[model samples]
Target: MNIRADIFSRLSRTDAHLFYLPPCPTPPFHSPPPQKRSPLHSRDKSKEKNVLITGTSLNGIGFESARVIAKHANLVIMTGHNSDRLNLAADTIKRELPSANIRPLILDLSSLDAVRKAAGEVNAFPEPLHVLIHNAAAPIGPFKLTVDNLESQVATDHICPFLFTKLVAPKILSARTEHYTPRVIFVSSIGHGIGTGVNFDTLGRPDPTRYVPMEAYYQAKSANVLTAIELSKRSKGQINAYSLHPGGIYTNIMNPASAPKEAVEGLHKLGLLEADGTPRKDATLKTMGQGAATTLVAAFDPRLDDKSGAYLNDCVAANELIGPPSSDPANAERLWNLTEQIIGETFTF
Candidate 1:
């Protein structure tokens, strides 16, 4: 199996019609992509730590990832725009892992100003932050610009997470007070390659080809991967960062509240996924929980401590960016620099 496919299952509605054992000659099923270097598989169970996960409200990747890490982490910080669900999730974790510390923060990530405020709060914590999980992302749906005038997807997925990770970096690195494995995992998606690669010039713009919502999401996700890679390289061993694609989980990814009603209805109508990994013998749809697994593995798995800067799928490291434009380490760096320019600051995270 291709290394990337092992880590992430790329199922697009565009391919839903092709998953079935169709009557026509089953068109060539191409071999999967290659895998990255496998880190030591055994997890270190001796240490207790803190992890911050974003965008986990209800049955999302953030919640699932929290469930996986609660046993190993001393504290888990969760953030989201949905206050009601955020409180509920925090309460559930507290009850489930009575010993684990769970803190909830409500912040709108679409605005860089709000992101800055959130970052400042994290920096003020008396203790160090060992892990920063940037899982929450707004899909490319409406042609909306954030309060910052940046595209919704780019601002939320790229700008907010990148800056937040930077703001928390010093605490994580300076915390020699404890044996810390500092990591930043940005949850990205395969749709990031909606059609092609990122357009450096039109990154935050609102236009036709430039404004295709899902296509924009691909750009932000790509930015996440690039930022993570650049950060890992910059910090050397001081900080570990990653861009991960949690496999297709059946989570209500594009919820009606968060996305268009038609978008959600169209996906249900497509019927391409299975929550349990029963390869959709009929179509390519995935269940919400199934989609959250890869993210959980990356955020909570101890085996990946030394393997920072990885892009993971399922429970393992995956290749660089997926889809058109292919994988290139140099391209990753280029995007990283371009992202920094967009936000007008170096990646201090």
Candidate 2:
């Protein structure tokens, strides 16, 4: 299953740009000012639109998303906990697109203080931030506490990102114009379907007596969806907030060495990897490019203007069977309140 070849085969049949461009032109809901131009324009105002993506390692979705979005976005900020990998990913993108304006920022999602400092640096950037992609996450073996005294998974996947988003909300809002709406994209997972809902009593700390590694991961993913929903509602359409399940790709998140055997086998059976268990480098499995497709769409798709809070899978709106739990208003609000309490700061939109 040569997935990359298949994608290229499909792309060979049409204008390759079709893969990245929006399906159709979607006019802004509001009329633009006389001199205001759409950010989608290739020249002038388009340079004002900047996008930030976290967790950008060499073969992950964040790196791929940055590569694709950099084709049009004026500036793409690629962030990660590792400085070397972050710079390397940015350099790789630059090699492919010499005109690309990609910058590297250090962001360790497990630490609230680090998130705050990163947000401060982002705020200081000369260009306004038009899009933020929270693409970094990990599934560890045990429930370890972070420096913030919270479960590592939830802290990285939800809490730190929640705080980062809140701190950067003003910058996101300030980037808005009649021609553009700032967007926040959460790179959630289909594992969210396994989650019941957030447990308010044991948010930062799971009950030690009844801890499950996968369950914790699912809960954090669900929290991602709920946070996006609550942020969208709180923003009153002023900002677009979305979460997505990037199609199963054989990335480090699912490395065979660290992941469960069954999980790895399932990925192999799904044609995302080879029999030897390495990610299928060919086009058969969903390539990193394919995994990043939905994130790119959710970030720039104009048709989503009225669909802020929507959960997307496979580059489109996910059905109720896989997406309903994350849509519960009560759960969203509950998580938002609990998050505010955990962070010791209330976010007012």
Q: What is the TM-score of each candidate against the true structure?
A: 0.76, 0.83
Query: Residue-pair clashes per candidate, as listed?
Result: 18, 7
Per-residue CA lDDT of model 2 for 36-103, tens digit only, reads 22223222223457989989988687887777777777899999998998889999989988998988
Best-matching candidate per lDDT: 2
TM-score of 2: 0.83
For model 2, state the Cα shift of residue 246 in Å.
0.9
Best by TM-score: 2
Off by over 4 Å in 2: 1-48, 257-285, 322-324
Error of 1 at 207 (Å): 3.0
